[model samples]
Target chain A: MSSVSFKDFRTSAARAIADVRLQSAIDGATLTFRTGRVKALADLPDVDGLRDQLKAIRSATLARLADHLEMFEQQARAAGSHVYWARDAAEANRFVLDIAQQHGAKLAVKSKSMATEEIHLNAELQNAGITPVETDLGEWIIQLAGEPPSHIIGPALHKTREQVAELFSREVGRTLPPDDIPMLTAEARRLLREQFLAADIGISGANIGVAETGSVVLVTNEGNGRLVTSAPPVHIAIMGIEKIAPTWDDAAVWLALLARSSTGQPMSCYTTAITGPARDGDPDGPREVYIVLLDNGRADLVGSDYDEILQCIRCGACLNACPVYQEVGGHSYGVPYSGPVGAVLMPLLYGLAENEALPHASSLCGACLDVCPARIDLPRLLLKLRAEEVREHMLTPQERLLENAVAFVLRHPRLYRALTGLGRIFQRPLARGGLLRLPRRLNPAGERQLPALAKRSFRSMWNEIKDGQL
Target chain B: MITARDDILKRSKQRARAAGDHPPAWRSRRQFDDLSRRFVDSLAAVHGEACVVPSLEAAFARLGDLLAEIGAGRVVVNDEPPFSGVDMAARWPDIEWHVAGRSAGDLRAFCAAADVGLSSADAALAETGTLVVTSGPGRSRLVTLLVSVHIALVPVSRLTADLFTWTAGRSTPPPAMITLISGPSKTADIEQVMAIGVHGPKRFIVILYGDED
Candidate 1:
């Protein structure tokens, strides 16, 4: 919330994950999402082939994305839809803000969108005196609590229903019983129904944007996304630059994988393909529609190692699958994006100089890389971020000192050999049988027995104690 | 406001002309099918679906008695093939019948209007009891989606092993929305209760028929 950049947002997310409550939350979410996804995709073997096809399609689409944008603009224009290109978050926010102000939208119903979250849209609108209402149950819960989303799909995964009951009781001005889920659903629904009916402008994010047709694809289990987009006469869709697919078929391929992977549903309850503003004789759809294509540092990724990051569909499958994210939730990432995808992406999109700690939040466990639907090499990018941090001299002085001291001790062969010889003598008291029981003060593993050195150094024993090996 | 967007687009057009479009190498379904076996093997190795049934009739018989047992009435039918034959007025005179058409009511109005729904499959996969339907008949998307208990009439010929057969741009053409339905709509977003048809159809029954055997 302060000027302190996300780069300073350092936490031992890997170590902190050992906490029982935190581990239980992450373990529950990750395994549930992962197992459900595995089941959903299990019935369709062609889905993997489709994923391969999409990998090529996504890479190809990202490569000449500027051209795709042009084609999409032409198609959308031809269909009587307005398209705006925003070079940054501010530009994107201003574009939508202007549209909302023009409509005099007293109540704006918004579906859950990480893109809008990234731009701080709700706050921006409130500052301008327009009420931005979050329609997703998880998002609405988070909004009322005055917090950001912690999970990609389930925004309010951080809070229990009991906590929700208290929050609702205060807002609804009644002591809503939280003994059961039906009460929770009824309480939330009673509140949102009013907002949906009153809202004049509706905003949403696209799962995949079809360039050939200039349609926005949205997959949601809750029908709020559909209601918001259609019930309101003025509908605005804010999408990241990388959301484009050359055609609808490509979009379908990704949609099939997305729904099955994200929530393990055969497909989302609603998969709406909105092409343009309403036409004559068309019944009950937004009369005025605007599509804001946001760059937000995506253009900078065009020719860089992080370019693979653009293949993401914003499904949040990586977050659900990442062990670290399951424990700390999304807020600990201290950015709009989170989890394995966020580790590589937050630095690139939000400015690496301010988000270096994001990359260090992972275990390099490679489980995230394994589960990514887009197959972005998350571990590789995290290592790349670490390298960048070391180059920038952004690491704390203590870490620098430790690394320097270790390097100095190891650089000289004589000193290294002599130190090992001396360490063996000093460690005799701590040695039990063949294992060294390290002193707790010096080593965290002290209580646990550590493997002792061989009877003789490798140089004096079996041959070849190579330099890199040591 | 419209004029400003048009002007910005006009300028963007000039800069955009310099870039090239990216298109991946796409092969015909015939070519893809030959290699598709290998493709399915890889997917099966990673995330395998449960055992597959080749006949839709087998799936239907398993579901038909179940639907009768549930005491569902007021059968609704979407405007599509195979199911276009199920007559609501003639079959059960006492039970109300609704057909999805231009005059078909909207989701909220009709979802509660029907207790049972009949739909025709756009395509069926032998590898799974999955039914694929497109939006040519708008009723197919909404009725199958909104009905409480839905029944699908699947022609055995439409069942294929490879998904590319349907997704690789169909030549005969069906409708606007291509929906591949494997099972009934289920959700776990609220307390992870596996609720069926919270927003879509709660139950699915497939009437698969083949001629030769």
Candidate 2:
């Protein structure tokens, strides 16, 4: 929604990041999530085996995605529901807007959903002259501030309690105190409750779509997602094409992993699996439930080298484990996503042209890959994106030429070794010890420190080798 | 106002089920070993707790032994198989085992009633330190939520290295809900200060169940 990815990372972060915020906000948030994942996974040391299984599962599922989709459609239809496929963002927006217009709806409530963010659903609905409210506290905060989410789980992670108090006071025309989470929460509840009672339409994002049952799985810490889907008659669930899983059991594992990874909760507050509207004698449920499967280039991904990308659960664990993301925050990636997965996914989902710099944003720490429950090879995908960006010539001319030269030299191991040796010898002045102080190529390297290289090249020393080195 | 609200609710259900095509048949779990490997590699990176014992008896014995050694008095247990053998009251007359199932109260209360919480997993991954639990008639989502010390028993048959392999198919085996427990509840909320069991369980004990138990 901000559409300001080009503002440069530092400039944007400096403008947004609050100084002297809660250490728990950073440490507590990251560690709680990290530890929950640890406890949940104490028995399975063979996650690689699981990753393999997941890979096989995703491939098989995606392979027959169309078939399964057809089955899910039939099942969903049989159970009395509607499924809409959006080729891209426009189609999704049009569908939602048209639905709102048809219902003559003026009020709408939404839960936290990345797919809606992908399609910019709120703006579209607004453009069509309808009010779409984000009911999640985090999304609500950011919505008021007019910024994209900094963290997937905590959309308003960028905001401090003080900032929230200020925002809330202003929004509600009341003087609210800063610092207490409950009081602030109470204020928010009072406000959103009014909307919930008044809204005619509710929107949500599905955690997992069970094809067999034609059920949409929704996991949430707060009760907002449930209310958004249950209270309003018109419930539109926007989910990515990849969120579909085989059955209830698989959705459970992902659900088990999701909240633990995202918020360190053993389980979220609510897990709603709505198959059709309400059962005939059901006391509560929406009258209508629409599932929008947005392709938005995912169909292409299913057939590409990045097919593993489809296995992503969007748990936000990758971002939390990401050092670069911790430092620069989500906005720095200049996309809806801002961590390692974001670096790779945004470029792929959106395109190289829009997010070329994101792939190179990480240190290739492999932390994202390490923490991913789905176990997507994030770094490999990252490298591939960088390479593809070059292949596509998305980089500036100078950057392209430089990148090409590096690639050419790297292709020939012998030449690369020779060039590095020669450069090290000739560039001794730039090297203090084992480290190169500055390459001199980076004019503004003052902000960054250069790494020192090994004194004597390992290959050269090894050629005049010593056997039984130990 | 209420009339329009009801109409929207009526319409939204129709929207959720309108399908482009039929839903595919559910797929079965395949390639267990490969799935386990990937799962372990991923968990090892996060520094999650993992233990692979040879037998269920050994795992439970190890669990009970550890609890006794720690002086933990009462215990709570989920209704998973192989749990019947863990006679906590017989071993430690002071120890109590609260049945973990639906109609459970606040997680803290359930956890407070017992010193140690033991749960039998729906599935287990040998590669990663994870216990998968599914929602059922008896199992409450809270059994895994509130305990200070949580113990999970995993069967070898469910073990896998790859997380992807299990996720491949359309059909997930019985157990409507599946949950994966890796280690004790942990939090790093305080200045990156790693604290175990901030909100849930502080101590995490695992039992890797095999043929014997």
Candidate topping DockQ? 1
Looking at every candidate separately, what fraction of the true A–B Cα contacts under 8 Å does it contain? 0.07, 0.01
Q: Candidate 1 residues A1-470, lDDT tens each?
A: 21124323433343334355545655676677889888887765565566677677887777677677888888777767788888777888899999988888778999878889888989988998889998777788888889888778877766666767788889889887767665566566657766766788989987877788777777666556666666678889998878888876677568767877787755565666666765553434577889998776776677576678888877678887776677666777765777888778877876666776777778898987776777778889899888988888988899899999889988988998888899888888878788987665444322345778766886865454444443
**Which ten residues in a row are the worst by lDDT in model 2 chain A?**
A1-10
User: After superposition, which runs of candidate 1 have C-alpha atoms over 4 Å from their true positions?
Assistant: A1-19, A39-50, A168-179, A186-194, A420-470, B1-163, B170-186, B196-213
How does candidate 2 score on lDDT? 0.64
**Per-residue lDDT tens digits of candidate 2, residues A263-297?**
65445545556666655433235678788777777
Of candidate 2 chain B, the 10-residue stretch with the lowest lDDT total is B4-13
RMSD of candidate 1 to the truth, in angstroms, is 6.7
- Scoring model 1 with DockQ, what do you get? 0.14
Q: Going through the candidates in order, what is the number of backbone clashes in each?
A: 8, 130
